[model samples]
Target chain A: MSRFSFNQITAKPWTLPEMVAGCVAAGVDQVALWREPVAEYGLDRAAALVRDAGLRVTTLCRSGFFQLPGWFDDNRRAIDEAAALRAPVLVLVSGGLPEGSRDLAGAREHVADAIGRLVPDAAAAGVTLAVEPLHPMYAADRCVISTWDQALAIAERHPAEHVGVTVDTYHLWWDDTVLEKIARAGDRIAIYQLADWITPLPAGVLTGRGLPGDGCIDMRAFHDAVDKAGYRGPIEVEVMNADLWERPGRDVLAATMTSFERSFRGR
Target chain B: MSRFSFNQITAKPWTLPEMVAGCVAAGVDQVALWREPVAEYGLDRAAALVRDAGLRVTTLCRSGFFQLPGWFDDNRRAIDEAAALRAPVLVLVSGGLPEGSRDLAGAREHVADAIGRLVPDAAAAGVTLAVEPLHPMYAADRCVISTWDQALAIAERHPAEHVGVTVDTYHLWWDDTVLEKIARAGDRIAIYQLADWITPLPAGVLTGRGLPGDGCIDMRAFHDAVDKAGYRGPIEVEVMNADLWERPGRDVLAATMTSFERSFRGR
Candidate 1:
């Protein structure tokens, strides 16, 4: 069965337990969880609780803020954290444009180099690093990887056995060549993320993504294409709506899962 | 000399004569006058006045709309108009997804095929066709040529001694690879358009464009980069602001030219 995991921002401020509970409530069987919640609650306890609640840890929410002076050490530490939780896929946000630096390609290269170095450690731990391409608007200030093409260019350089890309509709629905790119991506596409492209009120990334059905994107087609791509990975729901963020976390998670199923999986 | 051109929307509904006078008085040297303005005040007469005012027609507003049937005939008429008016470039707003079409790339191919055949005719008539990429938000309903790379691909396949691209900042300022793309584009760049990106507005495109100096894009860096790329073309000022659209024509023209100089090259 195909399943989706809300990355929490599809329902903001909701803890891992709450997201797990809500995903179960809304018929989602998997989740992509962030490290903060796991750390705060203790991984062993959280893992035990997740198993008891009957949810799969589809991916561990992240690693790769690769621009700091000590990013290598920090990134390695994150890989270690993913190992401790036994997460199947480690989701990476990649990080922002560094202070006073406008070198986007250079930052991307740093990420590739970091990932190359981390691959051995990741592969040994049986974890795959999922490179999530953010929206192009964040190309300068946030993640330098803004397209699956850009991400794959780097991933292709490394071993696909441990390194691959994530396809998020919110980040990619606008790409005129999205379907072709998705089909072309083939087996290297390790994750398929779901979120609708709501025009940001302020037109930036920290806010503005909507739930699956609230915006203009044809979510049904998007889901169908992902399904046809032959990769049965987690369809993680990740929205960064500021309005949804302030609402009761439970409402955010439950409502998102409901929309996700209706819009994403409904034929 | 870094001369600016008015993108007729700044003087909406005004007589071409009045708008031309306003732009010249504001020290602008050329115009990208719209088809409506030309139609309102007969094309021949409008051309005669713009020529008499010592202003060049940087580009005839638009000539591409492949999704709509009969577009070939309509676009041919536009090309004829461009030739008669001595417009250096004929802007092509490639039409969007046809009514029931889910395939953006297919729509793009249809557009390219339409333009490919038209390029010979455009070249024979001494007019260059310049593809103007609209922002990605308009991808589903407007032009599918949403990225420079995409536009460049079309330009490459359908090269006219007269076929090229119009680099509109409003449409592409967010892409991280723009600097490299523009640098590589060089002389193939026919128009370098300037507009500002605004935020904190509604959940749509209305009222989203700021005056050049009032927004966050590094306009000077862009101008300087294009210049360095050997594009000795006019920097066209095009604003799609709802507030400015509703203002008195003369004030809008003056405000636009002022904003252009402040945010771009006039020191």
Candidate 2:
């Protein structure tokens, strides 16, 4: 319970203030936030709201979409937002191939180059850029970084504090080599996120993740790997399911907590 | 055109006789057949129908689903069927995690062991078992083997003549390390398939694959790798799309040929 963090996206419809209040009421002292809602509620106000409620911001949801136009300025703004919110990490989902292009190698190299260019800003802003390797299914339209080795290679190019990898079970459980590599990652694992892989994925394949323990992923195996790596940071249960989103915020938070608890049971 | 082998699933509605006649009409001399349809058309008749049409069966579509109850006997039957059809290769899609189980490592080990046990039968039948590593998107419910390395590792254990790997561009394209590894695979490349990766994957994620040049996969790059490995065998264009299945058999084959030609245009 001490290491648990409620990521705001788990309850997509919750207002920032409502989420803050809900967290405080639920005795959850940590949260992970997204940029859209923060901007909607006003950044400073949202920051102040969480701070006044005595909640820690574990991570700023995302920043990197390097394939888009104006990504440089947009990422810098995201860095500033993370700093303002006192979040220690900003997640990077390296964008997929440019429209009508089949240059996956080029797109991946660009992600590394793009991250190198942003390391200085990240270092100065006191936020670690966590490069997340999304599931390979998303490689065509969402994130081109689709393997742990690929993400770690890019992160190894920079200082650990400025750039590290996000270890999300949902995106990585299929790889036979990943668990062993993750066990050796140590500080390169900036943030550990949990989302189970569910079958019959819906159209677009984006919002079909299962809550931890609801799907076939061996949560204990992942815990063993991360624990072996000496990571004792916030464990975020960040799931995105259309059905979960339709429920009330408090109910969703309760369900998330239940799933999180079930994942770590007997540990 | 001499290297082209049209996979029968590309035209799901075509009866075996209709497909055979259509292939002859189009000057197609090769095909890849599935067991269910061959069984439906009566295996001996289907075999003779294609053989009489002067068509070569490149591969018998599939055999391995090791997680099922009667996999051993079923796969044996599949090997015999492949032998009867004179298809030199039999592709294997190692089944996913067993019902309600999360031991992916254990499941993978079972697949390797099962294949090892079947190698003698495969050797006797003069059929090469082609282990296909499906896209990771299918890892949960379709095939636990989800990378070229895993497939190659398993194939390397047995004599290359008895066991080999299936290289499908759609499945292996997301892998950064695969092309170079495949270039060194040589005779382990039993079958080379082409299916492009398209976005907005429909429900189930099974039938959403694109025709060779209809999506983002760089088919020429695959050709370069396999060519470097000294492979001059048949190239099967195996696409599974709901919309494609709705089209007439001749139209689908024509479109597949056009896409296949376009993919190799600049090469």
Which candidate tops TM-score?
2
Tell me the lDDT of model 1 at B160.
38
In angstroms, give how far residue A79 of model 2 lies from its true place.
0.3
Candidate 1, residues A11-79, lDDT tens digits: the string is 657777777777777677777677778888887888787788887777787777887778777767677
Winner by DockQ? 2
- What DockQ does each candidate score versus the true complex, computed on alpha carbons? 0.24, 0.91
Counted clashes in each candidate structure: 1, 0
**Chain A TM-score values for every predicted structure, listed in order:** 0.90, 0.99
Top candidate when judged by lDDT against the true structure: 2
Clashing pairs in 2: none
Query: Please, what's the RMSD in Å of model 1?
Result: 4.9
Ten contiguous residues minimizing lDDT sum, candidate 1 chain A:
A197-206
Tens-digit per-residue lDDT, B124-208, candidate 1: 8998889877877667666778898887878877553577888887778767677778887866788888887655443455455
Residue A234 lDDT, candidate 2, scale 0-100 = 95
TM-score of candidate 1 versus the correct structure, residues matched by position: 0.77
